[model samples]
Target: MAQPMAELADLLTRLGTWTTLYIDGPDGSPAPERDARRTSIRDRMLRAGTPEPDVEVALELLTDDGPPAPSSQTILVRDGTVRSSWTSSTPGRGSGRRS
Candidate 1:
């Protein structure tokens, strides 16, 4: 079983390498080499074992930059178990409330 902190670190490693490319945005066009580098980073993340759900959650948290909503309930995990459940305003939202 993976520790929560380790799981978070693996997820961050994937996000740190993410990139994208756009041709001739409002500002100006980027050189082909820049686009290629962006693509390479994206590819690497895709190849990594990062879950798609985790990626979506990370993007929402980072880009929205808003206060988190309250958690609706608590989760209890038994020893040696691989999964746990909790409730919140949003479905699948774990009840790891922050102080």
Candidate 2:
């Protein structure tokens, strides 16, 4: 908790646009459905001006096996670098920054 907040505060001090993604659990979805969700997220991020490198990194971190245990994950990227990421037990909507 405190560690994540501290990392976020450190990230905020940098001078670059931030791209954040909040992903919900897989919720027992099939593999194909989860793949579709990944594709959708990738497309949306690319359309929203996120760099390809950052998007790839985000996707890699977000991926997991076996339905993912009803958790939410947040990823923060800046200048093609992933500065912070954390997972929570609570569910989160699949959301991303516009730019």
Give the candidate number with the greatest lDDT: 2
Q: TM-scores for all candidates?
A: 0.24, 0.77
On TM-score, the leading prediction is: 2
lDDT of 1 by residue, 27-60 (tens): 2225675456445634554577444543333222
What is the Cα-based lDDT of residue 74 in candidate 1? 25
Q: What TM-score would you give candidate 1 relative to the actual structure?
A: 0.24
Q: Model 2 misses residue 55 by how many Å?
A: 0.9
For model 2, the local distance difference test gives: 0.77
lDDT of each: 0.33, 0.77
Clash pairs of candidate 2? none
